[model samples]
Target: MTSDSESPFLQSARRTLQLEQEAVGALISRLDGDFDRACQLILKCTGRVIVTGMGKSGHIGGKIAATLASTGTPAFFVHPGEASHGDLGMITPGDIVLALSNSGETSEVTALLPLLKRMGIPLISMTGRNGSTLATHADAHLDASVVREACPLDLAPTSSTTASLALGDALAVALLEARGFTAEQFALSHPGGSLGRRLLLRVSDLMHQGDRLPQVALGSPLRDALLEITHKGLGFTCVVDGQGRLEGVYTDGDLRRTLDQYSDLHALSVDDVMTRPGKRIAPDILAAEAVRIMEDNRITALAVVDDTGHPVGALHMHDLLSSGVV
Candidate 1:
């Protein structure tokens, strides 16, 4: 019920988003040799990329570490506060360190600089100030500076954090491409996610085979085909020849059409009503692809066939949904 002129919340929210968007845009022009050097250091490292930061920077560092890990780079987050106590041991001499500090002078993070230097570990710093202590000590410094904070008071870490996150994503994507990371490899890292299901869940994994498959002989009576469909609960049955090779498919849709054209359902056979050269899929294809085919053909189910054209299995729309492949 509030008017736009009186509602500071909506206006403030828009200003924040606009400022953050501009901050991210500014990062594109700032990319230079330092960014490439950071990528090279990470690529050459034999061990994991150890990320550390303090305060709001720490939250962004954790997300950056996760993105790097999931995108083929071996990376993990170690709190800078914890590093001073004993967590520094997690970082090995072979690892590369990515430290985040908006001011480039976080005490918790700077405290470990000398020790890491002595250990000969490469340091990559992301900071707003080019002349900050952390940036000065870093082997490669990435400028993640923002012109102003989204906060009206310019106190909260909003635009700066957003810019840092976008830069992290850029680095991860560059490294992912350099390593020739594939969707299959990504799926291996994210087996429980929807992307993993789409890339890894093949037709063979979800298809019904043997007695579970809804199928009948090509000469099967229309009643027999209907019973097969009812028993299997797939709403369709594949019709195969005497050699068990797929010949056609008879579904509820076909049954309705037959009923409309001819009232004698008992006298009809599968050969009379079945769709010849019905849509078929191989078992090795992705279940997502099956969904696409079913959608494209306006079908609810499909028959899985072997190289010899023999019916091996059946895939239903419900199976795709149940397995999270849809």
Candidate 2:
């Protein structure tokens, strides 16, 4: 490898980055009432937003469609060439069309303008030229124009495509906020990911309950508490009253403190060292909340309690980690 201080490859890479940055940056000022109108149109649509484009725009359109669909807006991409064929039937009367084209006169995309108009489907155009055929025929035209392509020959689609993708992302986010989309709702849309696991998995789902729960009476010998912690492998044990309600907890930290404060371990009862009212969570609460509670209090395990304050289960930080929610 050459590893030159000023390699031509590095120079080209930097130029491409600078141009693409400016391309996306230019979109900020162009955002106006048309952006709002486009959002309103999609939000009001009873059906999906049909995105169409030719060449590079089609690739960006596909990503835009995915973002919109995942963020609460129902949307999908259709190739302009395919739409000209029998695939135009995919677009229904209730649907809206979002067309992308840099030149704004791409024959394949522009050909659909008349058909969309006759069907009374609202059209939102994202193009480089506002006066171009596609933009002039649309209900709301989004200007995604860039100064020039990052290509040395100004031929390949680089800056223009980046700008279009950014605009698509802007549209999806604005519509997401306008429709009051939330993290919980987004988690529902993406249930296979880590965020979904964290949000959807409840404490009851991951907690150790019944026999597996480490628990003993408050007045039990400290030796008994240590045995429970070791047996359950949760590094902590819940100390309960005679009524089975949680009175306190004895953890590895408490064990260390006890060793420092007292000379004898067998001489103590759980009441001599257990932390009263240790951090607890309801079984119905989200496991993510349990994680937050553990994080804020700097504790590893939590007592899962019922409305009556009886420990029903036990949760450990390891449980969250193993579940891919940490």
Best by TM-score: 1
True-vs-predicted CA distance for residue 80, candidate 1, Å? 0.9
Give TM per candidate: 0.95, 0.93
**Model 2: residues with Cα > 4 Å off, grouped in runs:** 1-5
lDDT against true structure, model 2:
0.94
RMSD of candidates 1 onward, in order? 2.1, 2.6
Clashing pairs in 2: none
Cα-based lDDT at residue 6, candidate 1: 68
Off by over 4 Å in 1: 1-6
**Residue range 1-326, candidate 1, lDDT tens digits:** 44667678787777889999999999999999999999999999999999999999999999999999999999999999999999989999799999999999999999999999999999999999999999999999999999998988899999999999999999999999999999989999999999899999999999999999998997878999999999999989999999999999998899889989997898998899899989999999989999999999999999999999998999999999999987
Least accurate 10 contiguous residues by lDDT in model 1 = 1-10
Q: Tell how far residue 187 is off in model 1, in angstroms.
A: 2.1
Position 274, candidate 1: lDDT = 91
Q: Cα deviation of 94 in candidate 2 (Å)? A: 0.8
